[model samples]
Target chain A: MDRTIAIDVSHLSKTYDSYRAVDDLSFQVYAGEIFGLLGPNGAGKSTTLRTLITLLHPTSGAATVMGYDTVRDADKVRTLIGYVPQERAIDRFLTGREHLQLLGALYHLTKEEAAKRIAKLLTLVELEAHADRPAKTYSGGMKRKLDIACGLLPDPKVLFLDEPTLGLDVQSRLRIWEYVRMLKARGMTIVMTTNYLDEADQLCDRLAIIDGGKIKTLGSPVELKIALGGDIVSLTLKETDRIHSLESELKDRPAIKAVRATTKGLDIRVESPEKALPTILESANRLGCNIEFIQYNRPRLDDVFIAHTGRAITESIPESETA
Target chain B: MAHYWQEISALTMRWVRRLSREKFSMLFTLVQPMLFWLIFFGNLFQRAADTQVMQAPNYISFLAAGVVVMTVLNNGLAGGVDLLFDKENGFLERLMSTPIHRTSVILSRFIFVMGITSMQVLVILGVAYLFGVQPATGILGVAMIVLIGMMFGIGLTAISMAMAFSVKSHGDFFSVLGFLSLPMIFLSSALVPLTAMPGWMSFLAQFNPMTWAIDAVRPLILSGWTEALPHVGMVVLVMLVFDALCLYGGAKAFRRAMG
Candidate 1:
């Protein structure tokens, strides 16, 4: 990658009345990289994307897309970016083809150019067969495909997708992931937000784990997992009240990196599970806490989230926050 | 400037296409005004109303102008329903995020409503012809009536769009729409002549724009160009000021919603 910055957000903050939706945040998205904002609902992911797309004005600070200031040169910035919002924006009364045709006109394409581009995009999203059907008849997956096709109408340099695979079936999600990778192959910079762990791990080149409208940590999935040291040993104990005692005992070991108590029990991060397994068993036996279940595995993104925010991402935030 | 109009035309065509696809709505929108107001109510009141007081050949001929202007008022006030739906569904956000001029959205809606209002006015005139009501000003005068209807619609539609942007929900918008349309129609000379109206209603009707529009259109249908021209000029001047205030409020509401 040439490391050209496609987007630069500096101290971007947005507030609704007294509630701060997006705090003073800063980040840079490199050209041709699929950057993901991984957070639970209401963690400021959509607000961040909306600001970058110029759908909103920031309360303070600034952002730029392709060097055009989002606030100052909004029209120029709009020419370079496409946004797919979290809500389904399809007009149920309009056919799939009509939607694209209208979008083409908004983008200022000539009649012939719009027709040609619409045909190509319909084929790309595999909606050509049902192009004449009203969007109300489309399935959930098909509607999302149409939304993606509409976003691609401008041949935008950057695409902002808010929860691209949200409410999608497994097959539809896999197909959307394939399409996203195809776009990245064509060198389009994609910035997507998702609360799904597997989506962030499988699709994003790098992600920022966010909480309470703040970025808890930021890195590639592999780098974040590796940063947790070696392996995670999760143990379920019968004597749940004595769990804190085991954490203190495990914390004294030089080989142990960190220990966290979850609903499932204690998760101990160790340099080597093989060397630390026997010590763990002996400590449990000495403490008279019966180990009902135990397992060891390489660090996953869940552990990475747990390591930074001190809680699992899925259970960390309430779902009441508007996406 | 060319690109701006092009975007507006594209958006206008979108509304045109959507309405065309609704086979039921298109049929009813044209038919309902004539069926209820012109044929049924016009005949029902044929014996009750004094044609001499109306200064026309019959009640229906005098009522013809009322129905025409009434169509413009109803269509214009209901114009923003589609936009309110678009806002709620997030399609408005999608359009705003595009590179097109923001004002094009409002202008395109204005064109679409006026086009439909013009079509309904023609249909109402045709139905009135079947009932032995002819415009004394002839074909050119009929064209003028449509133009006047569109001019009056421009102001009502602007106010409707402002309400759409200002209200929090469709429920509130509908409430406001109902509140404005029924009262405006009753206070005007649509259902009855100003000479036959109650003293207080006649006084209120003088201040109503609907009354100005109806009064302007009635002369074109019942009297010749000599009688119609003066009323036309007066309504035109009144509409210019009405539209200015409406568009100003509409633009302010649009800016606030966008922000």
Candidate 2:
């Protein structure tokens, strides 16, 4: 009921027959903030976004965009929000300029108004030179930029971007991130769903880490890292056989909380890796185990995900490829 | 309704621009049916006239009506393929997310298909005139037939678009539309008159809506609306029912697809 809430979802759920795609999910995106739904594939991130944008109906509970009910007042919600789907939703036959023109028209812009907005959006996305070319001719990044540009054409108060940079090159991803930041700075409330941890860390003001249709945790990047307890000391051992000895030796160390063997190496969550380094090395020396690699850093989103879900995000992607 | 009109205008403009840019698709729209008419229908009519089975004044004129209607039907039904492609490419989802009225999407496609069909009809009519088939009606009457024929075409298009939403793949949709169209064209008086067929064939033709449409426009092509009014009413009623069914089904499908 808060007027400052750009999006308010309460116990919202979506079930396809017997499968619950989104299970009693609840979250709020405040005005003028960049909120992220971070998850792996089939984590219901896209479904959540689709429901918020009124593209899909939720089975239970409720959601609202800019104070309008997503289901009962879909047209109003649609008018207030812009949705950028995970798959590029552009017409290949239309030029970038024409695509924007058509989208603007769909948003109820007059001809003159549409044309002016098209010009400004083209410049904003840095696709002015390629505006006249068919979208099929655009590079992956160019297509993504144009997709984002189309989403912004209505000057919407809330924008939902689902996997905006899924297949983009690093440079293109960074460019999109920059534009997203600019939108937030200009008082646009953005709900972006991304599987990429680094993207959420860099762009999101706060994030909800979702997995298996549930919210694992929700906090700012720094808050999440701090919640994971301490910095991580990751090491790649020369011999896999030494993992057991390493775990047992460092298990009760004052600076170390947990020592687990991962595919790459042993991951030791520590209060202070800088202080724990000498002790860890001495333990390795005692065991006569050679270290192939060692890294000590603050916990990443992936670590936070692992701490909550007990699985890596990358491996959690459904292998079927069809969904 | 105003929003629907605006959507139609915007979509029509988009199609026009694309057609202009592509050039070849427009040319294809004009020439493909002409080729079918010239080869298949022309040869059949010539053979029928030479054998003295055709008692009508001009056999080519009789065939011309069928060709024009067939062109409209073919183009109208195939227009749904664009919607299928939109689904495949994700444009449908984006369009659904906007504030535009849902019926406007269907109307826009109907308008585009109708426009393309009209141009094809002109080309067929020109060909008919060239082949020594004189129109019994004036230009206005001929226009009336074309407009009525286009209404039927729009109805078929609505059905096809609805099918696209209901069916899973483009190939499945094409199969269904093809199956429906071929039998309707063959059973109706498209290629030959019902009087020339057996009693059971005539009975089948009585129920075929295409038969009514062909009968309705045959007079306009042969002698104009004075004699065609009864058949025109029959055709219009059939088309109205088809259009209503398609619109209802398409709206349901649209809602399902969004879900």
Best by lDDT: 1
Candidate 1, residues A133-166: lDDT per residue as tens digits?
A: 9999999999999999999999999999999999
DockQ of each: 0.65, 0.61
Cα lDDT tens digits for candidate 1, B96-207 = 8899897889889998999888888888889889899888999999999998888889988988998998898899999988888888989999988888999999999999
Worst 10 residues of 1 chain A by lDDT: A314-323
Which RMSD values do the candidates have, in order?
A: 3.0, 3.3
Q: Give the TM-score of chain A, superposed on the true chain A, for all candidates in the order listed.
A: 0.95, 0.92
Error of 1 at A180 (Å): 0.9
Q: Chain B TM-score for each model?
A: 0.97, 0.90
Error of 2 at B246 (Å): 2.0
After superposition, candidate 2 runs with Cα above 4 Å error? A1-3, A241-261, A271-291, A319-323, B1-4, B48-54, B195-206, B223-227
Cα-based lDDT at residue A152, candidate 2: 92
